[model samples]
Target: MGSLTVPACVSTVLLDIEGTTTPITFVKEILFPYIQDNVKEYLQDHWQEEECQEDVQHLRLQAEKDKELEGFVPIPVNEAEIQQIIQGVVDNVHWQMLLDRKTTALKQLQGHMWRAAYASGQVKGEVYADVAPALRKWKEAGIKLYIFSSGSIEAQKLLFGYSIEGALLELFHGHFDTTVGPKVQSESYRKIADHIGCSTESILFLTDITKEAKAAKEAGMNVAVVVRPGNAALTDEEKASYPLVNSFEQITLHPVQ
Candidate 1:
């Protein structure tokens, strides 16, 4: 951060979801695994229901689309065909497609149910140890907190609302999802600035990925890339272009007078 230099104008904070607040591996290895483990049961239990069937089928359709694009013919899923979908999930190949609208929405709801599992000691959110303290200090400093993540808004809510350490959702004042735009694109940050009602200069973006930080910086926000373990392994180019911090604790804030 010392090298990249915090802009004097930054006032509010815009953060990423997976690596910034929660661990990436946590989502990939734990949360995703939980959803996969219970997916068949959840789908089976809710197949006939209106709300549930639509979502499950919606995901299947998306999976089919991906397969079709990959040149594999897809089979439609019904009660009898669902087992194959579960097989895809269990194999962990199809699970990455959770980014799709239908699957993403379903994943959001599943996060809520996973809350019970986490609350009952079945799972834990893998936030880095540096997370809680930095969040507390920043909140106390009156840096307005906001979220921008590809994860659906509801999933973001569930994560902080029923986090590993208990509910930390109250720390944030607003949330933005992919509905704004993709994280890698420039427009998403522009829309987020409008939504937050803060000048782009007043917003500081914190993420573990350099590409996102670069995008935010291009959008005129102060950018800090976290270099946490289990975070993305940056390329040499990423290293030169952004200020890097090993942890949130390394972030030093200077108030604009």
Candidate 2:
């Protein structure tokens, strides 16, 4: 592919993590399992603390909302019952119930637990071969690169910094997590533009998901849909509507008008 035309103003590149820089299965399977296996006990052991109490409240509120949304209601319960309920929610991958207000606590705790696994050689972060070299080349060309992922910024940093190829965080200028907003929402991309102090048109958004690319495009950003091998599930219309590439090597920045 040739360089894309924007206004003569593009200056930054914003990339997503899972399925873009990292494999999506690692997140959905390995990382989520690691988090789920630990959260119940982490919460149970830390329940008396103020932060833990807050997270419990969030879990309870989330559970209630989730039950209601699913056309059911949670019964009022004792502490033990609530613990069992929360554990069940996590185990079943009821993300709507487990990942909301205060989900950061669980994600952070999971990150800490995962550190040992990564350090002791039990796990390694998976990255596509194209990502690291492309990032370095972009950095060398004086383009500012930022990470926008659903993963916590700390988690993002850790994944890149401890990558199988080793500390690649040096290439990224900044990171954003769900605290900014959900990846599929236009506000998230807007917030990233504001945070970067650049016009949305000056930033190029790259991801494997169409909805996310749509969100960024709605925020006035140019979007690239990365079609990594056997990783994406784009619908038929998606194949015709955007710049689709098999690797970052296909991306070439054009000077904005």
Candidate 3:
């Protein structure tokens, strides 16, 4: 693994979940498949609830735009159209999971479904072996930790709260999701830095995605591109452009100024 000295001013760590702290297999093999298998039933069971209806409406709006983009005729949204809309939304959610799209509405709905799964012992979140120890070390060192993932904030909490490492949610100071901005956008990192009351240069952003790492770097944050089993392989050019680490144990932070 490659290494670089963390800047002395760094005081906060922003972590990406899927491939940074957790193995990608847990998402691909467990979470996504669980949602695909359970979502339609979850929707049918909860469709009348206020929050579920709101999310269904949001999915309806997205489905409408999708139909328009595909040149399909627009269906009028009405009480008579409600079941059709719900079914369409369910089909769309399945398709999005197939493609691994990270739209906010989809994530919000997934979080709700995963909430039930976690509560029922049907699924448990999996983090890399190195994550818990690293989190503890960083916390002991007084570096505030935050999660910035495409998952909804609720989903983030559920994952850590029910993680295999056991109720690790309390280890984090805050969480951010697509609600802030897309992970690949530099503006999102800037927003996170401001939200955390830290200078961009004083935060270290860790992710397995090269584009996200580059965006954090462009936002003036210290960035590390992580490499792990089951993560997307980085190109040689990408490897050359960012500091790379294979494990969180390799990360070392200096005291804040």
Candidate 4:
């Protein structure tokens, strides 16, 4: 597809992190592996914490529901059974991460694990070379910037706050997670526009996923598919349907109304 131009009326920019601003490797290679490596240890160490216990309880409930559907007998809640439950929750988390499933519980647990990693300087978030400059330019141009990702809000903040480019968290006005709704749902885009206090037409959403672009477009938001290294390559049809840009340098935002 030919070079795509940003809409002139766009006053807000909603961005996806992985494959859009950040490299896919940073997520799939670094973040996911970190979570998988630390999840069991983190869970064991924090089992007494209220928040950790809550997440474990949620996982247990989900496991029970799954077992019911499979016609398995429920485990009684006893001392020995609680130990089994903890192990079950740990196994379930690892399974979810393996499948890359987006569950609130898993995201929350990952966020907690990442907090220590980020704080300890074991991991720093990665973004494309062009991303920081583009973000700064857009912010200077009066375009409101927001992040919409499947990662929990805490995780989102930690990534940007400890990013390789420094605290880019300041550049973003707000963050959205699955808590707002799933990214593929058009209503999620509409809800983001509402949250930003702008007309859907006045916000530009950038993402690597074609389905996400279609959903944003369906919600009447301007959308552009961001093509980056390690991002899933777009089909010819997808490229034709949505505006596609290889870099943020190609994006041109109009003055805020």
Candidate 5:
């Protein structure tokens, strides 16, 4: 597709992860599997740590609420034998992941695991070649850049902080996670604009999901649907509804004067 110019009024650019700046494969194939395969070992190793215990407590609470759900996996209480508790937590995590659930309990543990993995060089955050340079250019142009991903804010930081290109956190003005709201909710976009001290019309949101694009548009922000290899296919109607870009290089941002 041809270059797409962002609105001249856009002063802030909000980005989504996974299929937007990073390849979906990295998340599906690398990051998540790292959690599933290693959660048992991670728990065993970090069981004594306060943070790990807190993560387990959260999962336990979430499991309590999920008791009525089919195929719910219960996490054993802390008083249980160490092995049983670890196995319970491990099974619960695997169950949540298999069903593609995005519970905060699941995300919190995953974030900590990913942090260790990234810090240990066992996994590196992957971004498209065009991403870093485009971010740099936008930053130089005085466009405030922020990330809004479903991942926990800590996880988001690890991805960019330990990215293949080295730390890129400096490129962003701030970050937002699902704690603000679900990505497909227009109110979330409005809240982000309010937090950024910008009008909705003066911000641009880029994502691989049409639902999110529609939500941002509903909130009066400029929107773009990002197309990346391994991203889910967009419908023809979606293509017609939003500006599409296969690479960040195709997006030319005109910062507000």
Candidate 6:
């Protein structure tokens, strides 16, 4: 595919993680599985910490709200034994993950687990070959950059901070997660622009999801649909509606006059 020329109005770029910068396989084959396999041991190791306990409490609350759903796992509220409560939280996490729910409770716990994993060198964040160099070029050009992903902010930090590229966090000005709003919501894009102290038109957002591209467009931001291996195929209509790039190197930023 030909290169994508970003408009001169763009002063900031917001990036998506899963399928935009990193391969979907890294998240599916590595990150998520790590949580499922190690959640039990992580809980046992960190249960005494206030932060871990707080994560457990959040899960308990989310579990309470989920009780009406069929096949919902329950977290023990007043269980006598610590082991029983831990077991309950573990079960609830497994159930939520199995169903691929993105509740804050689930993300909070997952983020904490990933932090330890990254620190201990159990996992390293993956990025495409062209991502770092392209980002460096943009930063040197005085274009600000930020990340917007469904992953928790802490998780985002861990990924970039311990990335295979080695601490690429310096490349970003900030990060946003679902705490701001769902990625498919136009308002989220607007809120991000506001947070960055820039006009929506001055920010370009890149994602593999057409819904996210559409939403950012609605919010008046420039949008690009990233095409990467393992990303969902875009429809003909989607291809017509948005700029598409197979790699960051394909995107050339035009300086503002």
Best by TM-score: 5
Error of 1 at 172 (Å): 0.3
Candidate 3's TM-score reads: 0.85
lDDT by residue for model 1 over 1-257, one digit each (tens)? 34344556666888887877777888778776687677666656655678665565555665666673533334355645667754543333234534333455456446555766766677755567777787777788777889888877877776777677777889889999888888988778998998888878888898887778878889888888877667768888888887787777777665534
What is the total number of backbone clashes in candidate 1?
1
Taking every candidate in turn, the Cα RMSD to the unseen true structure, in Å, is 4.0, 4.8, 3.0, 2.8, 1.6, 1.7
Ranking by TM-score: 5, 6, 4, 3, 1, 2
lDDT of 3 at 193: 92
User: Highest lDDT: which candidate?
Assistant: 5
lDDT of 5 by residue, 1-257 (tens): 67898778889999999899999899889988999999999999999999999999999999999999999989877778999999999999999999999988888899899989999999988989999999999999899999999888888889999999989988999999988999999999999999999899999899999999999999999999999888889889989999999999999988546
Tens-digit lDDT string for candidate 2 (1-257): 34444344667999998888888888777766666566566556665678655655555565565664543334344456766755653553335425443444345455665665677666678799988888887787777899998777877887887788888988999999888989999999999999989889889899999999999999999898888766768887997788887788777764322
**In candidate 3, what are the lDDT values of residues 1-257, reduced to their tens digit?**
75467988888999999888888788778988898888778878897899898887777676666764443333346566666765666677877666667766777788788999998889998989999998988888899999999878888999999999898999999999988999999999999999998799999999999889989999999999989887888888997899999988888787543
Ranked by lDDT from best down, the candidates are: 5, 6, 3, 4, 2, 1
Each model's C-alpha lDDT?
Answer: 0.71, 0.74, 0.85, 0.83, 0.92, 0.91
Clashing residue pairs in all predictions, respectively, total 1, 4, 0, 0, 0, 0
TM-score of each: 0.79, 0.73, 0.85, 0.87, 0.94, 0.93
Kindly report which residue stretches of model 5 are placed more than 4 angstroms away from their true locations once superposed. 255-257
Clashing pairs in 4: none
Candidate 6 clash figure, as a count: 0
Name the lDDT of candidate 6.
0.91
TM-score of 2: 0.73
